[model samples]
Target: MNSAPTNYKAARRDPHAVGTDSGKSTRGEVSLSSPDAMACLRRIAWLLFFTALTALGGVRPNSLQPPQQLIASYNDEQSATLRWEAVPGARLYRFQISEQRDFTTIRTDALLLPSKSWIRATIAGLEPGKMYWWRVQAIGNSGESAWSLPVRLSTNGEMVGVPVERLPADRSVLAFCSVLRFSWRACDGATSYRLQLSPSPTFDRQVIERESVEPYAEVVELVGGRGYYWRVQARRGSESGQWSPVQQFTLLSLANIADAAPSVKESQRLRLLKSDDPVPVELVPNPVADVLTVRTPPLHEGGSITLFDVVGRQMLRMPVAGVEQAQIPVGQLPAGSYTIVITTSQYQWVGTVEVLR
Candidate 1:
C-alpha cells in the first residue's frame, strides 16, 4: 500500500512539470512580436511601393521638339528674306542676325508669330563687302529650344550704272608698246568718270585718271607683256558709287602690231595718248620776278591747270581752251616755293617753281 501511494505522487509531479515548460515556450514566441520589429517591417513594405511608383512615372512619354529647316533669299543688294518650317507646339519664334561669323555681335533681333511659316523683312542700309549670319529659335510653353543652324548671306559691293551694259572694248596690243583701254556703261547722274590702276587688288596705292562726260578711257605707256589691273568709278558732285569689278590685260610687243602703217592719224593718236598721260608744264625763269609766266604743252581740248603753294594749298585754277601760256600775277604773292599742276582730260603733271624777287 505505501509503494502504490508513492508512484501516484510521482505521476502528478511529472504532469505539473510538463505544464510549466509549455508556458515558457509560449512566452518566448510572444517576445519576438515586439512593437519595434513590427514597425520596421511596415516601413520596408511602404518604401518598396513608393520606389515602384516613381519608376513607373519616369517611363511615361513626353513631347519631342526638333530644329526647324530654314531657307534664305536675297531681295536686293542690301536686303534679304528668311523663311522656315513651322514647329507644331511652338508659340513664338525669336530671330537674330549678326555680322560676325561666330554670332558674338548681334545686329538685329525680331520676335515673330508662330502661325506664320515665312517672314519678309528688309535688312536695309547695310554696308557692302560684309557677310551676315542669321538664326531662328522656337519658343514653347515648357521652355525655349535650341537655335536653328545658321544661314550665311553676302551683299553686293560692286555698283552698276544705268545705260551701261558692257565695259568699253579692251585696248589692242601694239607692237613695241603696250596699250590698255577701259570702257564702261554710263551712269545716269555721273558727270565724269575716274579710272584707277593698281598693282594690288585693293587699289590702296592707285594711279588715278579722269575723263569729263565720257564713257571711255585709254591707258597708254604700259609695259609690254605685263599684266595690269584696272577698275572704274562714277562720280557726281559729292556722291560717288562703289568701284566696279577689276579687269586684267596684258600688253603686246611692237613686233605684234598688225599693221606698221598707222590707220589712226598722228594728231588723233597723239590726242588719245595724251588724254591718258600726265600733262607737262614749264615755268619760265626759275627765280621769278613779281610777275611770272607759266606755259603748258598744247592740250588736246577740255583741259585745265591749277597752282598750289608748297603746302598743297590751292592758289589758282584756270580753264585750258586752246591756250598754252598764261601770265600769273604773283606781285602780292609770298616769297616761297610753289607747285604748278597741269590736268588734262587724260593726264596730270606737276612741276615746282620758286618765287624770289
Candidate 2:
C-alpha cells in the first residue's frame, strides 16, 4: 500500500483539482460535473420520473389483442367446456356466454388468468338442449381488448322430451276455414319437431306431414264440416321422443251451424247480401234480469259468443249460427262486469257488459 492510494475523493470534491499521476486536469476527466456525466444523470432522472408516473397510473402500454379460435371443446346436458387461443401481452382474460345473439342476457361472465397459450373454462348449470353464444377478450396493463367474434353452441343430447300441445284445444270446434295454425310448448333437448295431420284419429291416413325447427306450424287448404286429428313429436340428433297425445278439432260449416240456431228475420238475412259494412251489434235492456238479447249483423258463415268473468274464467260459449239475434241467459251469473268476445271465421270483437241487480 506504499504511500497510500491517490486521493480520488479529494479530487472529486474539488472540481478544479488535477488528476493524480495522470497529469490531467479534472475538467478533462470524467466526473459528476462533466457535460457527458450531467447528460447521463439527466437521462436517469427523466427515466425515474416516468417510472413514478407509470406507477401512479399516468402511463400504460397499448391495448391487448383479442382472444381467438373460440370453440366449445366439450358439451353435455348441463355443462360445457369453452376454449380459445391466448392473446399476447394479456395479463387476464374475460369470457362471456349468452342465450341471446346480442348478449343482452348474459349467462356466464368470468375472469381468468393468462398462464397458458390455450385458455379453457368449464361452465356448468347450462340449460339442456338450448343454443348459446360465447365470446372472449383480453385484458392487460393498458386496457381491455375488443370482444372476439361470437361462437354458437348447442347442448342437444341423447335424450329428447315430449312436446305438450298449446293452441287449438282438443275436442274443440273451429270456425270453417282453409288454413289452421297449431302450436305446442317447447321441449327440452329438441333440435327439430314433426307435425302430422290426419282425417282419422289413428293417424293412419296422413293428410299432411311437416317438419319444422319452430314450435308452431300452419296447415292450409283444410276442408269444412270435417273432423281432423293432429300430433307432434320432438327429435334431437338421433334420439326421438314419443308422439304427443292425439288431439282432435272439428271445422263446422255454415249450413251445419245454421241448423243448430234459432231462425232469423228475412230483413236480417237480406243484410248479408248488402255491400260491406261495419259489424253492428246491439244489447237489449242495458241491465237485464232474465235474458240478454244480442242483435248482430247477419252472420252468413256463422260465429260464436264467449262470456268471461273478471278473472278470465269462461262462463258460457254459444254458437251464433246464421241468426242475427240470439239470446244469452245471464240471470244465473253474478252481478259484476263481464267480458263478451264475439268470434267469427274472419273477425273477432270484444266488449264489456255490466250485469246489475
lDDT of 2 by residue, 1-357 (tens): 112221111112212222223344422243344555544654575478457646856544346778877755334566556667778777666677778888986655555666455776655555666888988877666666889888886776656778874456565565554556677788865657888889998877756888876787778867867888888998764456899888777767646644443223443332231124465877776566546677877655558766666766555456666778766656545688877766666556666777887
Off by over 4 Å in 2: 1-158, 259-357
* TM-score, candidate number 1: 0.26
Q: Candidate 2, TM-score vs. the true structure?
A: 0.37
lDDT of 1 by residue, 38-108 (tens): 34654575467446645655322123253465644444445455556767666555666787767885555
Q: Which candidate leads the pack in TM-score?
A: 2
Worst 10 residues of 1 by lDDT: 6-15
Each candidate: how many clashes? Answer: 7, 0
Q: Tell how far residue 262 is off in model 1, in angstroms.
A: 67
Best by lDDT: 2
| Global local distance difference test of model 1 | 0.51
Q: Clashes in model 2: which pairs?
A: none
Candidate 1 Cα RMSD after full superposition onto the native fold (Å): 34.5
